[model samples]
Target: MKQNIYHQFITKKSSGKKSFAVLIDPDKVNAKSIAELVKLSIEAKVDYFFVGGSLVISHHLDECIQQIKAACSIPIILFPGSPSQVSKYADALLYLSLISGRNPELLIGQHVISAPFVKKSGLEIMPTGYMVIDGGAPTTVSYISNASPIPADKSEIAMCTAMAGEMLGMKLIYMDAGSGARRPITEHMIEKVAQHIDVPLIIGGGIVDPEKAYLNCKAGADIIVVGNAIEKDFSLISEISAAIHSVANVNAG
Candidate 1:
């Protein structure tokens, strides 16, 4: 059997080796594009490929995962937006709970519907506390969940929420600014939240450039996720990966 990828992430965090994940929304990219992305991803040396989207109106999810797996050796983790997004082919699934939201549906309701299928799929499940920070616009996730994002400037709220997630035993805490966000998760928010949580912190959305990716790592994000950025410029996968992984995790010790 293959080693659990979640354990690998924990080990990487403990060793102060930051990681990068390329989010591939199945709804946005086709099989041919995914093949190209996988090749670029291999050259970039990304730690993980996050597969899923906020709303998948097509039947491409399973096909996309299979194609990426065939072309890339790296582990593909399912970052699903809903229960239907689960796939057995992926190495792991981020069993997410919208801990930052007040909506009962996203917090636990959906889990009840998806639990049976997830267990049957035999995919490694990593429970994640998903938090949405305002990225200066309305995002698909925010709209779909019907939950307001925590204000970006309210670092205290982010800190409290993250600490609660850690206490709840969530394996990871994901703070996203939403895909195509106008702004990425701020350094202050990342710093405040990371200080309060023990699990690996994953930040995503609006990370369009290498400099922003580097700053997020320096601010204490253990993993940085870039999606739309890579879609705009395939070469950025390597640039952003290097920029993020190169930063020293000052908080690791």
Candidate 2:
């Protein structure tokens, strides 16, 4: 099993190093595309690969992970949208709890069902508090999870929710605007949530450009995850990665 992943996240946070992760939806990519992505990711020095999607309808999950594993050493973390998404091929799993929603199923029900398999799979578990923020347009996650997102303008609600999740022993806090979001989670919201939580914060969804990725890191996102945009244009991998890493350089200097 891949070890010390949570430690890596904490150590990077303590050192003010920002990470860029490319999110790959199994339903979206194939063996050839995975090979291409892995090659670009290696060139980009991308920090991690987040695998999974809100609604994966294909059997490409294991094949995708195997192809990447065969190609490079970049860590593959499962960002599963359901219990069925768990795979032994990945290095770790984001054991997410939808803390932002009122849906009991997503908050804990899914965890209960996936726990035994996850524990047996030997995947390092990262207990993440998942918060969905309104992104100006409806997303598959919101619709499928049957939960309304926290309003984008409500930073206080986001901050408090993160604090509560941290207090409840969550190792990380992930703020997402959902796939293909019309607007990314705001800098203000990221700052507020970062200030309130000691755990590493991951911001994703609707982050399509290098500038937004860079600004998000500056706003205290320990990790920036990009997906949909990259699916359309794989070249963004290097550009966005450089932008995120530049934050680390600035902090180090």
TM-score (all chains, Cα) for each model: 0.96, 0.98
Q: What is the overall TM-score of model 2 with all chains considered together?
A: 0.98
Q: Write the per-residue lDDT of candidate 2 for residues 111-134, one digit (tens) a residue.
A: 898788889999998989999999
Clashing pairs in 2: none
Q: Which ranges in model 1 have alpha carbons more than 4 Å from their true place?
A: 1-3, 249-253
Q: What is the C-alpha RMSD of each candidate to the true structure, in Å?
A: 1.9, 1.1
Global lDDT for candidate 2?
0.94
The lDDT of model 1 is 0.90
lDDT of each: 0.90, 0.94
Clashes of each: 0, 0
Model 1 lDDT per residue over 163-208, tens place: 9988988989999999999978899999999888889999999999
